[model samples]
Target: MVDPSQAGMVAVGAGLAVGLAGIGAGLGEQAIGAAAVGAMAEDEKFFGKGLLMTVIPESIVIFGLVVSLILLFVF
Candidate 1:
């Protein structure tokens, strides 16, 4: 029911929100994975902590996905 201009703007906003979030998540995970690998390589005892830290990025991704979905449905 939206006019073409408004609809386009909304779609653009949705795409930006989701796309930027995804990029952030990807960067976060890459950093964590690298750190985990580095830590594990240096010391085996770091396994637990490294794993926890690495997986922490998953929450960022989940949050982004949730926000994207909410935006899609709510708007």
Candidate 2:
């Protein structure tokens, strides 16, 4: 009992949510990753902090995927 137009719109929205989030995550990570590498290059002890910072942006993608999944099932 799903309307085709509604379903298509939901699908498009889900795709956009996931794709844009992924792109944003990638861009966010790129800057952080560069800075992390630079810091690590300057000091060996910065590795742990750098790694943690580098990974933090990955949560954006996870959130986007969760939203996309919810949209896929909820609608």
Candidate 3:
């Protein structure tokens, strides 16, 4: 059986992990997205690469979600 205090701590840790990751990803994407848009505006050919670059930061959120799941269920 999990101790109540320990469980609470673990939950908080998991929440922080996901929340911080999301915030970081959002900040990264904000800059990348703006740059991508600017590049796309300058050259239509930049659309594909710019889109890929802008989407890359979203992987951080997925990683964070995995970590949170592990903490919640594996600990």
Q: lDDT winner among the candidates?
A: 3
RMSD from true fold, candidate 3:
1.1
What is the per-residue lDDT of model 2 for residues 1-75, given as tens digits with 9 covering 90 to 100? 458778998999899999999999999999999999999999989999999998999999999999999998988
**Cα lDDT computed for each candidate against the true fold:** 0.78, 0.92, 0.95
TM-score of 1: 0.70
Cα deviation at 42, candidate 3, in Å, is: 0.8
Model 2 Cα displacement at 29 (Å)?
0.7
Q: Candidate 3 local accuracy as lDDT? A: 0.95
- What is candidate 3's lDDT per residue for 1-75, written digit by digit as tens? 568779999999999999999999999999999999999999999999999999899999999999999999988
Which residue runs does candidate 1 get wrong by more than 4 Å? Answer: 1-5
Q: What are the clashing pairs of model 3?
A: none
Q: 1-75 in candidate 1: lDDT tens per residue? A: 556568767677777777787788789889888989998999999999988987776777677667766666676
When summed lDDT is taken over every stretch of 10 residues in candidate 3, the lowest stretch is: 1-10
Two-way lDDT contest, 1 vs 3, winner: 3
Q: What TM-score do all the candidates reach, one by one?
A: 0.70, 0.93, 0.94
Model 2 score (lDDT): 0.92
